[model samples]
Target: MKDFNLSYGHWDLYHKALKDEQRHDEKVQEAIKNNLAHLLSEESIIMTNGEGMARLPVRSMDEYKLRYGSNDSSQVGQGDGSSAVGDTIGKLPAQSQGKGEGAGDQPGVNYYEANVSLDDIEAHLFKDLELPFLEKKENGNEGEVEEFIYRDIRKSGVMGNLDKKRTLFSAMKRNTIKGTPGIYPITRDDLRFKTWEDVRKPESRAVVFALMDTSGSMGAFEKYIARSFFFWMKRFLETKYASVKIIYIAHHTQARVCDEEEFFSKGESGGTICSSVYEKALEMIEESYSPKLYNLYPVHFSDGDNLSSDNNKCVELVKKLTALSTLFSYGEINPYYRQSTLMKVYEQIKNEKNRFFIFKDKQDIYPALKHFFSVKEKATS
Candidate 1:
């Protein structure tokens, strides 16, 4: 007779597998973060309008598992040797498509796409972004955000909102007052319940004017890139602000205030006049969105092909806008890196509040967003 001993290492196996999975997830997260710009520029995400899933393609790192009789030659694609020359014989793995002898050397397409919700994407993105300069508004809606706070302790309220700790303290104090100080039994009168009140948290009320040039020079690529920036900007504003408003202005040689749909979709074959949009923005501000009550943000996107005569007017309007606006910015979509006449003219306008950005490709959209909206840190003394 032979003697044998057996032991089970189930926990060790489980631990190793768990660690591998965790590492893989961390790797995927890093990849997603690195490629966030590309992901943000995807047409699917930009057009989603904050609904549905945003699929992310991430590479898998787990080792393939094998099962008993799985992919068995006897049961899979194998026949009784009576097959025709041209007959189909099932499919082959992508990595196994080559007919070269010996082991294959080419890399396999091992990546898989994970569905991430729009809210998740927004959370990952908006957590790091905020308006450049947000000022407190004192006009309507005293503060920008309303928060419900539970601080007041009442004698009569719902049982679910009972403040047990406060009630215990009350009971102890009452017992102490009654000369039976130590750990006395609680009474109905000692019961305390938490009450809440709506608090208006102080924050800035902002109105953003999204101005875009819809000239023929603003081709499909330029339009898409511009829209991508505005898409994220709109989402960011909605996610972070409760009372903030965004006005859309689209212009070619002429400027017009239209609905969001017309702003993004309308195109015209005409000259480019960058100043018209700025004038429209100022008009809108004077008409409804007051600079006193609203921290104005006027952001313009164009191909920088404005008429030479209008350049000075654009600069003057921008200066006027900067006087009232918190932060005024310009984004030029110059794919060819050509020195736009308007860009050259904009460079002459010297003001801390006036900032201009140039993006040649879609990937630049994320960095542009960060640059335009990143929260500025206070100076340390």
Candidate 2:
């Protein structure tokens, strides 16, 4: 190969282009953030092509060619065939309408599509929401958890626990003082071992009870709204809590504990008895999650339809749960179910305005989440 001197000017241009691309990507991300609520809606989630993958639409600037004027001023098209300055010379093609058919040669507005994972989307969605009253509970016992944490060093310990370098130095010093220099001479007093103290750490535990009214009144759209809310709620809680346990309870006239897959997918038909799920949730919390040990969060999603006779019982259960839980949130999914007995019953309850929410459509999901995460103020009589 012939001797050649490489020019670094192209490298500088490449770096500048890379920085411009990065800035453009950030602008696209900001655009996505502005439409985050719409992107997280039920329609968007359903339209996603893959699991945990979402297509985000971003507005992008179209590439334009810059025209430069000549240094010498001259009017070339000022002949008799040319049109006047104010008159239109030629007509541009009309823009296509919404989802129009047929392929056109004309350049269109740039719309960039970015594929983002659900985890990334959740990070943006739950940026400001934080769990309140997160306090360390009782100290947990330190067992043989197999965690190698250097606690302390001592003079006596097991052979495995011996600090080899320290022990060798001590032995060398002792040998020098006694004038008995040997290659591997080590006395019992010259041995220094590493000691470990039991580290008692406070465990911050939290449990979330996701209760859904799977009665016949809750249509597919209503269930979708509830499931979307729960999906975001679970993602947000996982980010906030160190230890989070989610219990999915579905109920019609009776309630039963189920897995998350079943909770969102399964459909049941029966009379709406809102108290059954609340009672089951309370029982599970008392048995498994102690109020003193775990911060409890009981979230109920319903269509606001409940038996008139069971409304009082539901209210009582909610009152008890609110007293035990760190936060109690109730989300009514159906807009037409406004005159529901359950909603009326909850309206009679005191000091739950911040926690209770009404979600009419997919648009209401963001507001409902804000309501759930909003700080509660003390209520006066």
Candidate 3:
């Protein structure tokens, strides 16, 4: 069997195409329209250009398909068609059929896998859209090329306008008059065109703050799990978003912000109050990050060894933290003890899935990290 793998960008394009195929179904189309009315013309806000042209980003999968998918049988679409070809188009002979060899009591592999081309995907998303290609020159000036061009009729006069009928005759006469003029003819700067640039949107930035306890009770094994969890989270977050802010906080009796070196390297022996860790995180956000714009995520690790009286105050601080964050997640790595008072407080959160989490041992770290990012809450929807 052949193994297949695709990059993140490739997966994005694949899903975009899958979405296009599903849009053609009427039931799917209606459901999409009802749910995504904000993406439609009537419900969406239209931003107008300086030339008074109202523009909206392409949001309809069906519309994108018609303009750029397999159904688009235009000249431009045909230019970049798929290369996959089977010379024998008709049915195969019975002997040549390897169906029964692999078949059991159930039916065998009857479905044929159609290889879709990348051109087909690109066509569906970029059809009728003006794509600008920029080439930087040695002198620092940029040269531009447009995939499509149109000449203005009024400015070019009736004879030299974009009309196919009159343009040829006007061009012949104009070239003859200029080409023979005292060996000094027209320069290359005579062309006048109105070109628009393709607007590119900026990638969204997200920050994931990992706060871990280095208290003596955390143990070496628990620390290993916590560090491994942070590494995995960093890799996964980097793949998903363009920029990721990884803030590490190590707390023993007290908490302080630390860099990547001190995060997994330092060890301590003291009491724990989880609230101090959160307080530092809150301060970091207030000083630099804006809750409204940034995708704030906080993941904390501890052995649930915090003081009993601070549990209620810790819960209150978490509630305050949620208002200033996109999501708040807690990972309690209780190594020796069966359960702790701090774990009980976190487990009782109103939105337990979104704002809180609990883990018992080192084995739970991987699953806990996965669960933290995988929470699809009603608020996020």
Best by TM-score: 1
The stretch of ten residues in a row with the least summed lDDT in candidate 1 is 7-16
The digit string of per-residue lDDT tens for model 3 on 84-196 reads 46533345344444655555454333221222232222222222221011112233222232233443333233333335433444445566676742322333333222433
Q: Residue 72 in model 3: shift from native, Å?
A: 69
Q: What is the lDDT of candidate 2?
A: 0.73
Local distance difference test scores for all models: 0.81, 0.73, 0.56
**TM of each candidate vs. truth:** 0.69, 0.66, 0.47
Model 2 CA deviation exceeding 4 Å by range: 1-17, 42-52, 62-109, 138-203, 352-354, 374-381
lDDT of 2 by residue, 1-381 (tens): 257654322221123344355555676568667877776783545434215556666566444687787655532344467666787654432342333656755566666666656655666777777665555565552121223567777788888998988888888888878887643688788888888766544457778889998899899888888888887777787766556789999999999999977886778898998899989998998898888778788889999888888888888888988899888888898677456667777877776432777777787888788778656565666
Model 3, residue 302: C-alpha shift (Å): 0.6
What's the best-to-worst order under TM-score? 1, 2, 3
Residue 250, model 2: lDDT of: 95
